[model samples]
Target: MSLTIHWTDHLTGIMRRAADPPRLLVACDFDGTLAPIVPTPAEAALLPGMEEVLRSLSTAPGVHLAFVSGRPLEDLKKRVPIAAAGFIGSHGLEMQGHVLDGVPGAAAAWRGRSPFIADAIRRRTEQLPGVFVEEKPLSVAVHYRHACSADAAAVQALLQDTVNGAREFRLQEGHMVTELLPAIGCDKGTALCALADRLGVPRSAVICCGDDLTDETMFTGLPNALSIHIGPGPTAAACRADSPADLLQLLQHVDAARRKNLRKGSCGS
Candidate 1:
């Protein structure tokens, strides 16, 4: 969990997986992993050249790209806009490329409950300056990044209390926000795994990366895959990228590797 394994030291094997056999399912967390974390959700967007890198990799013959995020699916698309890329959004409650038709009816019903949850949180947090609420179709999030440290803790306590009182929802704490989503036995990892299975990618060829606690599901769920964690934190990922910029650099290399393999008409061993 201390993350002693740096991604730079394992470039060879990682690049090989990118260009080699079985086809690679590359999924990455959007905020703070693909794009730098911002003060507000509206301010978040991909960094320069990140879009091109992702597009290139997504179009590579042996590579498939997907964005796994806590944001809504439409918001993720609006932010990324990569044609070849697919999306798993709202912390895996809803996805673009793949549909979880088997998800429980009660879980699917949470979309209607989100408005009530968001309204409750907004009312409770209204007194705290800089505290705001974002309501997704299947989840509700209280963002306190702009609030004082004291207010952040208060927001967390309030969110935790709500989750404790509500059995159907679970609390998901991220960088500066707290979210509540239906406890439908689904998460980023499960969603990513489901997507990979649908795509026919083997466990060893799955490459997923992320930067938060929710992303930890992706890391632990695919231990055999090349899992990269962005930024400072104890993580279950196999390697670490110091920042989003570092992750972009890694993607650039991975894209190049895929291209090189395509040109040579052979896969890496």
Candidate 2:
């Protein structure tokens, strides 16, 4: 079945149904959300106990948890050994158990074609100096913060030119980095929607949290769910959580709330 969400207004009705609080399908993005934004993408790691908290939530009754990330599935597994919980990797390009409607079934096939691009970008930038490329399994990120202002500009121009003719991929700009990834229909938003559908939960029962441009994609078509913006953003449903630790604290609160509600339901029953 194909499912797509397009608004938070649908949440009001679900919130009403959830006055008794419905079962929740909670999802979050890694990197800027579950881990801090480090200087290099490779250096980005989850805060201590972050994975444990996710595991706890995944096991908690009334709560369903998933790690939705831009990083590849293998990389996420290596970094966050979440067992039995849902994993949505590669900016929703890939998922465990199910594939999203708009995403190509053979999408990962393109993963290998990008290293050549990464090497070329790296070789060119190495000469101009300071700029560097951090290659991931499914994508490559060009970072310029360590480069001199002039060198960074030169590298950016080269990147823009390199990506101009490629229809198979495009660039994703984030804090001091530009990532080259396959151009496709998958994104965090679609991934979350797909997960919620697979879990058989109403959109209102979903809560999504994140802290970057890639995360903003989850907000695009979210209906019947809390679209939480972690740091200050131009949206109304925003909540400010200063760091990854803060995000973990917030998840703890949600877990507690779900457990309490479940216990109450059990007692009343």
Candidate 3:
């Protein structure tokens, strides 16, 4: 059974544990966690007041915030536009403003390969109505949200076959879209770990929030971190929030707790 949690009952404990570490890492998935899922990906935006809350949290002392998403690095930057926070894009394959170490030339190689792969998928699925290809720098997403049930299934099957026979790519299905990303040993979990390592924060000090199957990797990969799932489903997450509004409330509580701690420290000093 899925664990159902109340934010009011759990927020204080979560804040207490999160505040114990020297540094805290607050990372979240962008699309469904921060912004409501929309029919058109480009139309998705952060829920009202969330951008300000994130900005405040990002500026808080010893707290590092990041948005980890399947979107391309540039796209994520365009959407969030907070210079202080970090961004892990392309499902952890790309990091904004920095090159991933030990993956020398990976960016260039992926750039070179993406078009060909995207073109191939486009050619294969063009005849299917409502099937459109969204090409990113390091990945290609085949969105079939507008397709009929039969057409959607056919598109998925065809894409699966196309990717299965390929040597350097893999398929990731989410909602009504299927994405093809480079066959790399990285994902949201690894990305979160890398970010923590880069920031010198312990995994126990991190809190990851997400709302999809892709986010499950982060929840399972970081066993020490607090994981919160955004909607109803069986998940590895320890807590749950019913909607974006509920998530906003939880974040507001965290912000308040962190500020209170800071003020208390100041008064003691």
Compose the digit string of candidate 1's lDDT tens values, residues 2-26.
8448888999988887778747778
TM-score, per-candidate, Cα-based: 0.94, 0.82, 0.93
lDDT of 3 at 25: 85
lDDT, residue 212, model 1: 94
lDDT tens digits, residue span 1-269, model 2: 11322224244443333334456777787888788877777898888888778887776666667788877777876777766567788788877743333345556677677688788888788786657787777778888878888887787778788778777777777666778887777778888888888778788777787877877777766755776665654543334465677667767766665566677674111
Q: TM-score of the candidate numbered 1?
A: 0.94
Error of 1 at 145 (Å): 1.0
If the candidates were sorted by their lDDT against the true structure, best first, what order would they fall in? 1, 3, 2
How far residue 225's Cα lies from its native spot in candidate 1, in Å, is 1.2
Give the candidate number with the greatest lDDT: 1
Across 1-269, the per-residue lDDT of candidate 3 in tens digits comes to 68657555687688786566667889989988899998899999999999989988877757788889999888888889688878888888878632233332554488777788789888888888999899888889999999999989998898778777876777887878888887777788988888888878888888899998899899999998988899888889888888787898888777776677787673111
Lowest lDDT 10-residue stretch of candidate 1: 97-106
In terms of TM-score, which candidate is stronger, 1 or 3?
Answer: 1
- Among the numbered candidates, top TM-score falls to 1
